[model samples]
Target: MSDRQTSRAGMALALAFFSGMLSSSLPTPLYPVYISLYGFSASQIMAVFGVYAAGVLFALAFTAKVHIRTSLYTRPLYAGLTCVLLSSLLMMFADNFMILILGRFVTGLGSGILMAYINRSLIKLFDTEVSNTAALTASASLILGQAIGPLITGEIVHRGFYALKTPYIILFILVVMSIFGIWRSRLVINRHCTTVTIERKSVGAQSYRGLCFRDVIVCCMAIFLSWAMASTFISQGPTLARSYFNVASVQLVSYSLSAFLLVAGISQIVMRKKHHYSSLKIGVVAQLAAVLLALSSVHTKAPSLLFISVMLEGFAYGAILVGAATIVNMVARQSQQHHLINLLYIVGYVGNWLPFSLSVMMDHFTQETALNAYLILCSILSTCIFLSAYFAVRCQNITGRIRKN
Candidate 1:
């Protein structure tokens, strides 16, 4: 393929990936609507939210062992897009809770496949800096889709439009357009240069084995924690906010969640020049602070404090995501890049799954108390994880010096 053709295909692939992620989170703001309409308990709502993560995990596990031809990314890309389109349609017409859950699960599966492939292709096709740029571009697109879904959905619902169905209808249109773009651009890569060959040249056998100690493990843990915090806020924050602040407006809830995601995307772009480690440190500290503010906001019933916490959480989300991806890029061999990315996502989505337990907690305790306890636990655990990563890196550096001496 020509250079121009490759670039166009690459861009189209990224947009398709974005569309998938957007579809995955499109139902976030509508959880309350569903609860009202269906009389869903907290457990049922969380079940609906967590099912998507389960789909992501299943896709990642299945793809980890397989070697997908880069040239064939478009086939699965469209298939995933079609799945998302079907999911949106199901959500639009669903009268039963089971159907809604099914829609979310399908959306998750579609997003998981597309995200893994897009990240793999971008890293394989480009150089370090170029791939990193592309990765961030794709990540930002994911965040943008996430932000836009809730923001638009809330507006539609608040304005008394088709409410639950309008968001999916609009999403249906976007997916169709994305599919056409991928088809028209002929988004295929050169299969002759496989990721496996690149991996062999990038890292030797011993260095590859040592990945468990240095970069991949730590980055994965950081990503897990980051996504845990983020998913809690995105998936459950609206429910908690309504319970605490008597927030009845869907638009406000949507704006609040979108603000967190928008800040995350913008912060990543603005601080694109910083080192990954530095970003991780700053992000962890911000998350700790956000947790404290979140606790205070719940106690005092202060929206202002909650807003501050949201912004801090955004910083944390952006930093950890970029940091984790950069670390994997720095440490993994070329061939392992795609698989490692998939693994990292798997870990991250596990965090998303963790918040679902709050439904059980809320059953026994007040909403404020249960949420506060969860936030505190996450903060303390995140700090410990950060410290562990720090000491591990320090020990590795010391061992390196001893070997040199």
Candidate 2:
């Protein structure tokens, strides 16, 4: 395939990836809106969010057992896009909690499939030097799409537009456009590649028993922590922000969440050339600082401090995500690449639901108490992640020296 053709295919893939991620998070800022409209409790809304993560895990598990020809790479992409479209369609007319939950779950299914396939597809389409760039592109597109989705919806809803229906309509349209782009590109699949299959293995016990096991564990932990932090913010940050600032504007909440994700996206691009270890170190520190700021902001009711906290959280999220993904790419064998990536995501999505427990805690405890518990939990996890990363880097350096000798 020609360079131009490859570039076009990569672009098409990125668009699809971005669209799928955007659709998955499009409802973040609208959770409060749903509560008000449907008269549901916060725990129920959190359940809706948890259901989406469940869908993602289900898709990952289901896809892990199938083998597809390399030439038909677009098949998963098409299947994912169709699921996303269905999600939007369901959300557009959703008037009750169950429908919203169903919509979010379908969107999760689409996102999981796209996330599993997009990076691998990009790697196949580009040479080694360009493959790194492709990976960065995929990561940035994912973060940016997530960032923009809520911003767009929040703005539209704030402007007295069709608060509930307009965002999904736009999402539906975007998914359709993404489908067209993929169809039109006629993506030339890499024929030299063998069948793409995800090996079925116990990712926890058996899979982590080699020389590179420590590195794999660290990478998995990093992704899990990073995504867990991001999901907590997506699922509850808006309401928390409102409580801290004593305001109730959806746009404000959306803007704050978008800012967090936008900075995360930009940080990924800026730190793309750095060593994965350095990125992980920086991310660990930033995450700790962000948690400190969040604790302070909550106590002092300082909006500025809260926004700063949000930005730091975003940086931590992006840096950790990129570092973990790079490490996984380096350590995973070609045949086991899909399996490892799926494992990473499965861990991360499970973390996605960790915050749901906080909502349940709020039922029994004060919001402040729940918030403190959650932040403290995050701090503890962040420390563990840092230790894991430190040892992983040490292991890798030792292995490299042994290889050279």
Candidate 3:
């Protein structure tokens, strides 16, 4: 295929990937609407969110060992897109909590599968430099979709509270278009007769045990901490905004969420040149600052401070995620890279699940108090991540010196 053709095909696949992620978060600003309309409690609302994480976990654990085949990416991609379409329809028509959970769970499952497929396909399609570019583009697309989901949904929901289905309708149409885009791109690639081959299926038994490596553990922890903080805001921010700041407007909720991802994406792009460990440390510090500001916001009930906290959280997310991926790639065996990445995401989604469990606090304490507790938890996790990275870097240096001696 020509360079231009490959780029275009890459962009098309990127869009499809973005569409799936966008649908995943399209409900961020609408959780309040669900509570009001479906008469669900905060805990139940969180359970619905948790179901999505559960679906992701289900996919990760079960599919981690699947062999990668070139002709296979489209199947999961198509299946995931279909699951997202079904999810949108169910959510649009949902009148009960059960249906809502089902919808979110299916969407999570779809996204989990697609997320794994797309990353592997990138390796099949491009060289290291080109694949890295495509990977960053896809990552940014995922963040952009997360940002756009709330912004668009916020506007729809705020304009007419009863019109909460508008965002799903829009998402449904986009999903359909994305599915078609993928189909067309696939046809184009096939027409070129560009065949993808898996030279070897497994790296080796030794690299399979590479999961026990200390640096790998630290990178996985980094992914978990980064995503855990991001999920906290998405799952609980709306309720906190309404209860604490009296800013119940869906638009503000959506915009704040959007700002978190937008800033994070930009941070990743701007700091792409920095050393991975340096970026990880700074990211951890930024997350700590976010938690501190969050505690202050809870006390002062300052919306601006809350917004600033979210922005800092975004910066931290971008840094830690990129840093973790880079560090893992540096240490991962070539043939075992896919397995290592799967492990990272499995841990990451577990981080996503933890914050949603915080909804139990709603029964015992005020929302502000519960949120303050959540921020404290995030602070502790951030500190652990920083220390882990510090020691991992130290170990890497000591090992290098030992080799020299």
Candidate 4:
């Protein structure tokens, strides 16, 4: 393929990725709406949101190896897109909590399958080693889609349109457009011609030797902490905004969530040229600052502080995610990239469920107490990530000097 063709294909894949992620979070701002419509408790609504993670985990477990064995990226892409389309239909017509849960679970499945292949597909299509450009493209697409979904949905719903149905309808159309784009890019037909065969010569065993287990653990922890914070905001931020800040407008709440994620994506773009360890350090500091800001926002009920905290959280999320992904790409061999990436996501997805589990605490404790507990947990995790990353960087520098000597 020519350079132009490859770039076009990459864009098409990015759209598909973006659309998938957008669908995953499309219902975020609508959780309160669901509670009002269905007369469900907050915990029940959180359960609906949390089930999506379960679907993602299931899809990752089964579909992570499909592309390696068949060398057909388009097949899984088609399957994932089909799942997203089905999910939209379910969500559009959903009238009950069960239907919402089912819709989100299916959305999770589609996202999981897409996430498993999209990065590797970009690397293969660009015909390059795992590079920062590819990492940025993949990370930025995922975060931006997540950021934009809620804003669009919230705006439409706030306008008193078909609040529940219209957003999913838009999602369905976006998925259809992405499917067409992927086909037009010839990724569908080219799947048959391009065969990526992993040699069966214990490459996996050798791959482990080159990787630093400590670094891998830190990367996984970084993503886990990042997503944990992001998911908490998405699932519960609106309620908090309305209750604490008296920001009663759904559109305003959506704006706050979107602002957080938008900064995250933008931060990744800004730090794309920086070293991975440096990015991690910046992310750690931002996370700690955000945590402090969050506690203060809750205490004073300051809307401005809440917004600032949200943005800081976003910056931390983006920097940590990009840094972790780039480090994984740098350390893992080509053949084992998917396995390691899948593992990383598995850990991160687990974090998606962490906030919802706090619903149990909210049942027994005051909202302030439960939230403070969660924030404290985030602070501890941030510190651990900082220390681990610092040590890993020191170890790498020492090894480099030894090699030179």
TM-score of each: 0.83, 0.86, 0.81, 0.86
Off by over 4 Å in 4: 32-44, 65-70, 96-98, 187-211, 241-253, 296-306, 334-337
Expressed as tens digits, the lDDT of each residue in 248-361 for candidate 1 is 786687677778888899778865676666676677777778878888888889878987888898988898787677667646443344688788888887777778677678
Checking candidate 4 for backbone clashes, the offending pairs are none
RMSD of 4: 4.4
Model 2, 1-405: lDDT tens digits are 778887788888888989988987788768878888789896798688778888889988887777676677788989999999999999888888889889889998999898877766766665352135655767788887877887788788789698888988888888898888788765464345532233223222122223354666777777777787788777677777777577578677766777788889878887787766677678877887887887787778788887888889899888877766665654554335455666777887777777767888888998888878888888788888777767766775666676557
Q: Which prediction has more favorable TM-score, 1 or 2?
A: 2
Better-scoring candidate (lDDT), 3 or 4: 4
Evaluated at residue 105, the lDDT of candidate 3 is 93
Indicate the worst ten consecutive residues by lDDT in candidate 4.
199-208
List, residue by residue over 319-340, the lDDT tens digit for candidate 3.
Answer: 8777666555434334455667
Task: Give the number of colliding residue pairs in candidate 3.
Answer: 0
Instruction: Indicate the residue-level lDDT of 17 in model 1.
Output: 78
Q: Which ranges in model 2 have alpha carbons more than 4 Å from their true place?
A: 29-44, 96-98, 129-131, 194-211, 244-254, 296-303, 333-335
Question: lDDT of model 2 at residue 51?
Answer: 87
Candidate scoring better on TM-score of 2 and 3: 2
